[model samples]
Target: MKPGSLSHGSSTAWGKALRRPAALQPHLPHVRTPPTPRRAHCPPIRCGQVPKTPFEGFVARPPNSELHLGNAWSLAHACELSYLTQDEVRSIAEGRWGLKGLLCYGYGDNDGPDTQCFAAAGPDFIVVAFRGTTSITDWVRDLKVWKLPDGPLGCEAHAGFLEGVQGKWKGRSIIDSVLQGVRDLERQYGKEEGLAIYVTGHSLGGALATLAAAYMLEDPELRDKVAGHYTFGSPRVAGPRFKKRFEALAPAGRALAHRFQNREDVVSKVPAWWRAYDHVGRWWYLAGDDQVLMRNPDLWTRLRDIIDIDWDFQPDFVYDHQLRAEGTGGYIDGIEKNIVRSA
Candidate 1:
């Protein structure tokens, strides 16, 4: 087995289930509201309750060894995007793909007060990576919820993350730049050439990546080109409506989307999935370095994760949400360590 990765019994049931296609139905019309926030003093972790959203049957595949090389590559790119400089990004990513062209853009103000994404592109694929929150303002952004325009393709998302993508840096929309980068690749490579498009990020970047990919897939042409969607320690992004629409838009089999959650990586469980916010892809959970196994949540298992805040953050939700912890299972350490092992 790969370093730090353990194998379970020879069962590959989870991987097999992922490959099996699921039927899609036309969306049902209904107004959905966000779940009421729970008091923090109470144990946020749902003890034993089944979630309204489908949670059973989805499985977390084993670590590095079981993941597709492409998935690993995508994760590596996402890590580089997490904090590395543009030159550093190019240095690490260019040698792997035999890529010729490189383009990079910084969308938000990075002056230690704002959250932003440093998106980059290569000849065959495009990557949009977001930086985690670094300020009191950013944490506040994470806690506040505004009704996202609801419709056939609408659901509530974290207002701050949405703003980061929708707003502009120097008057340019960050999300637009991401879309344009993929389009440029497609334009150069052409459809018949089978250009592979991918989107990835960590923490806030992961959430933004999901939003950008969902929006891009809205176009029929772009949907066909998406090769992978990978995220690490991503908080839940949108409500069930957006998820259903995204499901219909991307579909299974056609889109190879995977969401990775490490042990106790608090961000992955936030903005509760039980609430209107739901995740769109299969989850690859890493249960430390022990044997890897795949199984769905039991009937009594709760889908929504209550983010238990630190005692000191009694009144400040922002600082409570902005706690910093990183290591083997953390956003940066997990990816970087795995990349080193694979290399």
Candidate 2:
């Protein structure tokens, strides 16, 4: 397990999907708001409750794992963009894959951040390594959640997963470091040149990205140093309360928070949404459909000039009360559910 990670975080995310009965339809139409120009607002943040948008990106994508095409594309986009701005790139590349290889993706080759014309001016590069896939040595009974170890498999590799229970994001250390990296960056470089932090992953990587965003926004003192949040294929992070808390915490909570799910993807269906965090919004893609997630109250929040993408946002889209694998579960009861606001 990566250091400072919340163990069973995936289970927590998946809990929402598992405990519910597949019933209601998903709410999406409410997000359909009359187009309006986005405006930035600075609202005071509250703890354990309401969250405010502070223009930060808390990415959970580790650098050392095997990324699917979509995730790689997202990383490439974010890395390229970060390089252009000369912002520091701190990649938590530990876990499943390994840092040494993916770390170069950010700072190596002609396409590396260092080679970019603006790279000299690019974001600082930082990499965090966790109990990645390749590193996991032991396992006992491979359950969907925690892989129980019996002998060698359970003793060595599974140890990390167990340790993760205490860490912020399942016993992974990157969680705290990711936040600290920005806090240090903010202390060193005031949000002048602009910082672009991108957190992404393939499957499990996507889940990590969500938690990282939540953990970063857990405190409001350092919201200003965030950048873009681009998750390739992620499941849900918090529950309805978590979402509510996030919405109350940040106005632009859902800004640039993109969850890219592929056609008939499996992991994408694991961390289904429930009442865990009531603040964040879920964006579902139906290929032919425009955008499955929409509720316009915070539509104006995405245009800010910050560099990071924080979780804890308000949304217009919702799945069935139960995590359903098929059909559009519980959707909008009223247009307001998709477009509610603070008067």
Candidate 3:
């Protein structure tokens, strides 16, 4: 056959193939639900060490939020780049954060930090913070005080959050925990030059992740220390002013590593658009903020239920992933590397 003739035939074939039936088309791999006999736990979560999956050098524990593949991938990347190294990073456990709620991402818990699952190393962090939350510290000797769920990624809350919350829907325990975690990191790896203070979380935990970053940015000293953040399915926390406010105080490049997901994802849609705190002015000062369409995250995945029962459920994590990969997470990490690479 002539070269031009062959080319023409290929083009024609491509066009014809485009008309194939929808069922006959190929689709991207999808995450299937756990089999009928799911993890016996109420809201199943998996926590464990990802030692072989490209994260050999780091130690990790799944925060019981949701041990998602994407979150795990991002966690490995962050640790490798020195953006967020696993250490004696500490976190407080919530009353099994995700399993009992529908809006698991909502900030609605607090109580004298009931337990300290010090990761001398363990899965005490929000294995999920909802994706297998882990720590970088081992100061404590035993896990006796730990209240880990059945899965490896179980997490009630991390150490840095605000105290005396729960009822107020104002969570800062996660905040304080992070601050302390940073101090711990400084104590342990301070001599390790080029070290960065980074925070990451997926879904409900993403909200906490942002909250933690915000607190760190509030302090010039702390902000300068942190390198960046990587979040997946993070909801819209605060408003436009948050970016500016954090930048002014921290000076350090702020990055929100964000990734969105389609199914069983309620985090991105949390802090519902209708919340008064959606704006910067409110979020920074308001006491108790509520929103329309908000549901109890204690029972199930709100967004997923909505999609599965109320609307067409063809959701995509691509947009959420793009928002972070190309925007904040990637851009800020680049800047940090340029500046802190040799520091």
RMSD of every candidate to native, in Å, equals 15.8, 16.5, 20.6
lDDT by candidate, in order shown: 0.49, 0.30, 0.31
Q: How many angstroms is residue 54 displaced in model 2 relative to the true structure, after the best TM-score fit? A: 25
lDDT of candidate 3?
A: 0.31
Model 2 stretches with alpha carbons more than 4 Å out: 1-172, 188-196, 252-256, 272-279, 282-343
**Is 1 or 3 the stronger prediction by TM-score?**
1
Better of 2 and 3 by lDDT: 3
User: Which regions of candidate 1 are displaced past 4 Å?
Assistant: 1-70, 95-97, 107-124, 134-137, 150-152, 189-191, 251-255, 291-343
Task: Judging by lDDT against the true structure, name the best candidate.
Answer: 1
lDDT of 3 by residue, 256-287 (tens): 23232322333355445554223111110000
On the 0 to 100 scale, the lDDT of residue 310 in model 1 is 30
lDDT of 1 at 250: 55
The TM-scores, one per candidate, come to 0.62, 0.39, 0.38
lDDT of 1 by residue, 168-274 (tens): 65566767766776677567654455565666776566777788877677757677666567777678877877777776665444435677665445677788765
TM-score of 2: 0.39
- Most TM-score-accurate candidate: 1
Task: Report the error of model 2 at residue 205, Å.
Answer: 1.4
